[model samples]
Target chain A: MEVAGLILIVIGTFFDLFGTIGLLRLPDVYNRLQASTKCVTMGTCLILFGFAVYSGFSPAGIKALICMFFILITSPTAAHALAKGSYRAGVQLANQSVCDLYSDKQVLKISAVMNRDVITILPDASLRQAIDLLVEKGITGLPVVDSEGVLLGIITEKDIIEYKTYGNVETAKVRDAMNINVQTLPPSAPLKELVSIFSQEDFRRVPIVEDGRVVGIVSRKDIIKFLKEEKK
Target chain B: MIEFITGVLLLSIFLALYRIGMGPTPSDRAVAIDILGILVVGFCVIISLATGRDFYMNVAISWSLLAFIGTIAIAKYLEGKGFDE
Candidate 1:
């Protein structure tokens, strides 16, 4: 048992040493976190396990077990938190990085692809008027804006369908059928954030706002187009 | 045998310190500090065995807890979204 424990400890020590070396040699903060988190956690846990094996069922062995469990739970979590925090804090990735999925390239910004000539409808516009504009423009949705172009809500085909099922479409107003709680993104937000929103939420289109006015709109088709271009 | 293990652990600790000293980012330093804490815990366990004193085991347990907490605190501070935020 002693010999086995000693061997384990020795191996673990090597892992710890390698982790330190990687930490020193890795190019960026993210890579360093990956190295240190994996190597050091494995090394420390192995050492503790070896200690437990040598000490048997004794109190010291039990303490070693507890320490092993603590290290297992805490080390990786701490590394993840630190990495996320560093990313959020705007720490630049290494220049050698081949690709950055989260990078906010100017080409991927909302302002780059969004249609600036948004065909919008006034809140008081009749459902017939909204439908005519949507059909004429061949669009699935339209932004409901005030006279000053401030976004009030969004009217989509789904809203029109729901409104038609309930009562007379001729009497219904755009505001009556439009979704009031609209999700808007800033023009400068990255395409990655938009992708996540599209995946997680039911929004088919996201309006881009600048200085409290709707500057442009991005839809699912726009994202598909962007991604297709990105592949090239 | 224990002496050899101690020597290796000490060497690793020194390497980790070198990282902490030269790490470019706060997260790198935080990782180094965490590795150093783990090494300290290993040292404490080995000492307890070599000296045949159960008291050292208790110290090891406390040290490990402190190290974990310290690493978490440093990580949170680096993240800038602490409890105050």
Candidate 2:
């Protein structure tokens, strides 16, 4: 074998070993992904190229060349998939993130959707009163707040129907019938996470809670509207 | 000659390993492991050439496939789970 061939092989191996060390030392998912993809792809490609050179254009060299190309094409793509999966999985950034560019900060802060003012209700409110408020506003449901204005539960038309289902609509207050176990979203919560929560849970209305107070309410309709707006 | 390349590859692998150890999160570690897998395949290919055997090339190809599958599976698991409030 030529001395140059041996040198090429040495260089390729060094690149690979260096990439492995990088994979072991990185600090976070995204950063690690960057290191992993860049180092591994380049390292492997060079190493394989070295093998092709050393093999003197034999069948093994051709195979090595093919594998090198395939790795070059697929390595970066696989890294991208890993990054996206990490994002969708709700992995938090390690350092102080400069900004969440993808989030709709305004929508999360807005008091209403499509200009319909969000309203609240109390747990002790009568079913008829709750129904009347819904009819007056032409809204589906309203978040229920306590005396301190903290979110306690939610009252929706579905709650009314369920109350009527057992023929127990008499003197029971909203506390007795309203869905207490609710899904609450923080102001910074992402819409994807919100959707996941809704899908995994049995709740229709989600309360937007900020600083332990009910800021707004999100219903199935709200989610639909948000999705529609996103599509547009 | 083979020994020198293998040794240098070992050194580079150590460097990647260092990155993995200092990673801050699981995703970071996952990425690092992926890079390591590619390095292994490259190493195998070189080994096939130095030793004049077709078998090592096959092993290298298989290693690449296995790495790809592992990466996809882990990514799927990450995306498939839902967050609880």
Candidate 1 lDDT, A77-181, residue by residue in tens:
777777776776667888556457765754356677777788888999898999999999899999999999999999999999988888789998898999998
Instruction: Give the alpha carbon lDDT tens digit for every residue of A1-232 in model 2.
Output: 4566666666656556555555555445776667657866887887777777777678888888888887887788789888988887777764434346654564343244322345988888877788889899888778889888898888888888988888566666778778777778765665556666678887776777889987667777787887689798
- Cα lDDT over the full model 2: 0.72
Q: State residue A44's C-alpha deviation in candidate 1, in Å.
A: 1.1
lDDT of each: 0.83, 0.72
Please provide, for model 2 over B17-39, each residue's C-alpha lDDT reduced to its tens digit, 9 standing for 90 to 100.
66568655566666767777887
Global fold similarity of model 1 (TM-score): 0.57
| Residue pairs clashing, model 1 | none
Misplaced by over 4 Å in model 2 are: A1-4, A103-232, B14-24, B82-85
Instruction: For model 1, state the Cα shift of residue A72 in Å.
Output: 0.6
Per model, state how many residue pairs clash.
0, 32
DockQ of candidate 2? 0.39
